[model samples]
Structure formats: structure tokens, C-alpha cells
Target: MRLIATTWQPVWHETPLGWLDRYRAALAEVAADRDTLVVFPEYAALEAAFYGTVTLDARGWMQRGANHFDAYCDGIRALSKDTGATILGGSGFARKGDQIVNRALFCAPEGEAWLEKQMPTPYERALDMAPGEAMPILATRFGKIAAVICYDSEFPPIARRFAEAGAELLLVPSCTDTEQGASRVEIGCRARALEGQMIVAMAPLVGEVPGCEVIDVNLGQARIFCPPDGTSPEDGTLAQGPRNAPGFAILNTLSESLAQARKGTDVSVFAHWPESETPQNPPETRNFR
Candidate 1:
């Protein structure tokens, strides 16, 4: 399967129609050859708040995003239908009652589904955003997939459940203010791919949006990771893009070498995963003499 991770920057002045055009152009860039899977960065929907006249704080921005939720999703749906590409439309704020929740929408030609971030950053919590309750593995024609929104990618349990559910691909959409923050998420992506023995791709929000306080001075890099064993890249990095650049990291995930590495490799981490759970011998405590 071909995968493309799109590093994006939110435009503070774009209207709903402008957003539609931007998404259409981005998806078209990757889907030129065939039906490709594209992942966008988190909080791309925050740009919707820019339509308002007032300067919004974090919570106010999230509320504005909630107001335009449907239009945000509809743009992705139309793009998916038009380009015949499967897209993870980054994470957005959705109002589920009086509380706001951060959610990621996955759109395909057949239909659309969504996943929420179980864990939110301190900044998000301060904005009154609620964490999600469910972790679902999305099923698609190419492969079973899952998404971990920004900070959630740092938790192994979240990614493990999806890996256990037979998901072959994990998409991570992140938005960080500093390069250090982006590096933390990058480490999480690589760690999860190594442990799960699956493909892990990340798309992060890059560049700054003038007058947008929440997204000002954004920093991130697009990257794809595979197992570091003999089956894939020794360093586990399949592709990486220049930091804070708005572009795509396009690569082929389905390789004969990777398939062979999974089945028979120098060391099969996927095959030996159960060993970590079941110990050969139980620990015995010895009293000090």
C-alpha cells in the first residue's frame, strides 16, 4: 500500500470554501498515481476559528471549531470521494454535550468514521477539552488501521490495543509548539512501530499562522517508521522530511522484503511478543542473611 503523510499549516484567513480548496489540492497531490492513503496533522480544524472577528483563546478557539464541525468533515468527505483516496482528516474539536472533545475523522470512499484522543495534553486540558472513552481499530480495504492523536501516541497501551486487534498501520497526527515537543512524538512513533512490528506514519502541523495564538510558531516533521530488524530499515526510519516544511512523505509500505522480514527474520519481535507476557520462570525472593 502507498502511504503519504502531509505536513500542513493552517491558514488563519481561509473560509470554509477556502478550506475545501486547500484540502482538495493536498489530496490531489498524493493521489495522482493511484488511490493513496493520506494523513494530515492534528488541529487543522482550528483554522475554522479564524473566521471569527474576535481573537479567541484556547477554549474559545475549540468552541469555534465545534461550531463549524460539519463543514470541516464535509470537506474531507468530498475530497475522499473525488480523489478516491483514504484520508485521516487530522484532529478537531467536537462538542459532545457541554464539553468539547478532540477527535480524528477517517474518511474513505465507502464512508467515514472517527476516533477520539484518550489523552489530552496539559494545554488541551486547560482549554476544557475532554478525553475520549473508546479506542477503535478502523478496518479498510488496504489494511486495518488506527489513529493516535498527538500525545496519545506516547502511550504504548493505546497503540498495543490496535496492534492486538490486527491493525497493520497506525497513523499519528500531531501539533507541537517547539522542536523538542515534535521530537517526543517522533520517539513515540518509532517506539510503537518497533514494538508492534507494524507501519507507523506521522504528520505534524508545521509553520506559523500569524494572529493565531494557539497555532503560532508551529514545529514538526513528517516521518514514516518500520521495524528496525533485518526486514525493514535498520534504523527503522523509512522516510523523513525536512523539519517545519509543508509537504508529503510519500512511500510504498507494501514491499516483498518487508513481508519476508515479518515471516522469517533474524529476530522476530512480532512472533516473540508473547514471550514478554509469559515468563519462562517466576521470580523468587531470597531473604537476606
Candidate 2:
């Protein structure tokens, strides 16, 4: 399977159609291959309100997002069908009844599913976005896949659960304003790939769109990683895009890549992972006195 990790830049427009066209263009570029999977970063949907239909401030964006959430999802569904490619359409605020939740929409040729962000950042919490339930291992034709949205990728157990559940690919969609923030996400992606022995791909929101308070300043490169073990690239990075650039980092993976790696490698991290989870005996009770 070929995957495209997009480094996207948000821009304010006078009309939603104009901004939506840019998104369509990006999807079209990836869909040209048909079988390729594309991943967009967290908060990519918030860019729609950047057209100024809603206030450019954080509060305004969230409110408008709630109001227009359906249209946002419908558009992605249409794109998925039209392009004939699977897409992880990035995270956004979606209303789940009375409360708004931070959710990422995954659209495949077969169907669509929502992967809620299990963890919320301070910025998101301030916006009253609710945390999601535990992640699920998603089944797909290419292979089983899982999602670790933004900050959630930093937590090892989230990816570990998915891996144990038979996920071969991990998708991480993120947004960060500073290089330091981006690095933390990048490190998390690398770490997950190393320990899980699966393909980890991250697409980050990049560049600045003035007036969009929530994502006004963005920084990060889109990249794909695999285990550093001998079965895959020694460095673990399969592809990386230029920093703060708007483009896609594309790479191909075989159906048996992860399976073969787990079975053939000198060090079987995936197999050994279960041992780490073995219940430990109660700690010994001893007093220095």
C-alpha cells in the first residue's frame, strides 16, 4: 500500500468553496494513484471557517465548527468516493449529541469511521472539547490500521493496544505551533514505530494563516517511519518532507512488511511486547529503619 502524508497550510478565504477547492486539489493529487492512502493532520477541518464565515478566533471557530459539522463530514465522504482512495480526513470538532468532541474522520472505499481523540491538549480542553473513548483497531483491505491523533500519539499504550489488536499501520494527524512541539510528535511517531514494529505515518499542519487564532502559526514536516530493525530502513524513516512546506510525503508498504518483520527479525519487538505487560508481583515491603 502507498501512503501520502500531507503537510498542509491553512489560508483564510472570502468563500468556503475557494478553500474547499484547495482541499479537493490535494486529495486529487493523491487519488490519481487510486490505491494510495492519504493522511491529513489534526485540526485540518478548522481551516474551513478560515474563509471568515465564522470568526477567526478560537471560540468562533469552535462554535462555527459545531454548526457546520455535518457539511464538513459530508464533503469528506464525497471526496473519498469520488477519488477512490482511502483518507484519514484529519481531526475536528464534531457534535456527539449535547457535547462537542474532537474526532478524526476516516473514509475508505468500503465505509467511514470516526476515531475520537482519546486525549485532549490544554488548548482543546479550554475549548470544551470532550475526550474520546479508547481507540479501536480498524480493519481495511490493505491491512488493519489504527489512529493516534496528535497528543494521543505521545502515549505508548494507545498504540500498543492497537498493535496487539492486529494493526499494521498507525496514522498520526497533528498540529503544533512551534518546532519543539513538532519534534515531540515526531519523536513519538518514531518511538511507536520502533517499539510496535509497525508502520507509523504522521501528517502535520504547517504554515500560518493569520486571523485563525487556533492554528495561526503552524510548524512541522510530514513523514513516514518503520522499525529501525534490519527488516526495514536502518534509520526508520521511509520518507520526509521539507519543514513548514505544503506537500505530501509518499511511500509504499508491502502487505507482508510488518508480518515478515515480526517473524524474521533478530529482535522481535512485537512478540516481546507481551512480556512487558505480564502482571508484576506486588512490590516488596521493606523499611530502611
Candidate 3:
């Protein structure tokens, strides 16, 4: 299946309407090819907050009360219907009654959505966004897919659970602040793909937002990960924005080459290393070998 990963370079301080216009144009440009599945990065929807006084410790700033968050979801629904494309709508503050959750919306061409991202990172905890309880693996014509936002991918258990639940493709929507941040995220993407024996696609926000550290500098990087046998295709990368410019990185085909690599031989080099001969209950060293 063809997957188009859109790494947005949103100006952090723009109004919702302004952002909508820019995003709509970007989406139109990226979706020029009708049959593509597009994925946006985290926080691309709330660029305004980045330039504001919203700190990780300030819960009030991150609140997305029912009416507002619902509107966002409604907009996403419309986007999916209009584009006739499947979208992993990145991460956002979703309200459920008086509580909020760090959530991702996966909308199919039929205008139906499946929400995921059960766990929020420590940074998100400041906003009092509740962690999700269920990790859903979606079934699509392309493959069995699952999505996790930013920090969730840092944890091995979460990726493992998705793999166990039969997800063949993992999508990650991230918002990171530094080039190092991008590197770290990309490393995790690779690790997840290798360990799960699946394809991993990561889209990160690539522009500056005045107040937020990540958005204020040149810190955006996006990449796709596959198995190492040169069979899964190259890792797709998107621009860092401003100087580099914003655009989409298209994965023309979601190859199952990684799975093929693991069929007869261990494709994970780290897992295949010779085991150490140390005893299970070796005596404690006391200045002697």
C-alpha cells in the first residue's frame, strides 16, 4: 500500500483558522495522488499553543474542553471524507466529560475513526491528560495497523503489545524539540520495526513555535523504518522546514520484506549475537575471577 507521511512545518503561534487554511492547502498538495494514506505529526493541530505560555507543568493551558476538542475531531472527520484518504490525525487533547486524554484519531475514507494512544508521556502528565487504557490494532486493506504518539514509542512494552496484537505496521506521530530529539525518535522507530518485525512510520512537526523549545529552532526530522535486509525499502525522510521547507515523504509501497527476512533466519543482528557463557548463578567476584 502507498503511505504518504506529511511532516508539517506549522508556525507555532497561528490562530486555529489560520492553521486550518495552511493545513488544508498542504493536505491538498500532498494528496494530489488520490490513493495515498497520509499521516501527520503530533501537535500540528495546536500550533498556537507552542507560542503561548503553555508549559509542560501548566495543566490549564493544555485543556481542550469538550466543545473545542469536538470541533477539532469534526474537522478531522471532514478532512478524511473530503480527501478520500486514510489519515492518522496525529496527537491532540481529546476531552471526555471533565477529563482529557492525549489521543490520536485514525480516520478511514468512510469517515469512520478509531482513537488510540492510551499512554501519555511524563511531559504530558503535567497537563493532567489521562493515559488510555486500550491499545487498539486496526485492520485495513493495506495491513493490520496500530498507532502510538511520540513518547509511547520510547517504551518497548507498548510496541511489543501492538506486535502481539497482530499489528504489521506501526505509525508514530511525534513533536520533538532538537535535532537530538529527532535522532532519538528515529532510533526508537527503528528499534520498534526491527523487534516487531513490522514497518514503522514516524512524522514529526518541523517548524518553529515561538515559546516551545522544539518549535523555536531547527528541530524537525521525519523518517520511516523497515527491516535491515535492504528488502523493506529505504527509510523515507521529510524536511525540517523553514530553511529546508515542509513536505510529505511518500512510501510508495508498504513492503512485507521485513517479515520475509525473519521467516527463515534471525534478521535482528543484536538478537543473533553469540550468547555469553556466564553461568546463571555465578559466584560473586571477591577480587578473583
**What TM-score should be assigned to candidate 1?**
0.90
lDDT (CA) per prediction: 0.79, 0.81, 0.64
**Which residue runs of candidate 3 sit more than 4 Å off their true CA positions?**
12-16, 32-34, 48-58, 64-67, 211-218, 233-245, 255-289
Residue 73 error, candidate 1, Å? 0.3
What would the per-residue lDDT of candidate 2 be over residues 155-222, giving only the tens digit for each residue? 99888888888888899999999999999999999999888888889999999877668788999999
| Local accuracy of candidate 1 as per-residue lDDT tens digits, 1-289 | 6788878988855455777777777766665433578888888877655654567766666777788876788877877777788888877889887888888788888777887888989988888789985546777765777888889999988888888788778899999999899999999999898888878899999998876677878899899888887746778788877779898887775444236435545676766787898998998999998
User: How should the candidates be ordered by TM-score, best one leading?
Assistant: 2, 1, 3
Considering lDDT, which of the candidate structures 2 and 3 is the better prediction for this target?
2
Number of the top TM-score candidate: 2
**Which ten residues in a row are the worst by lDDT in model 2?**
47-56
Could you tell me the TM-score of candidate 3?
A: 0.78
Best-performing candidate as measured by lDDT:
2
Worst-scoring 10-residue span by lDDT in model 3: 235-244
Worst 10 residues of 1 by lDDT: 255-264
- The deviation in Å at residue 112 for candidate 3 is 3.3
Q: Count the backbone clashes (under 3 Å) in each candidate.
A: 0, 0, 4
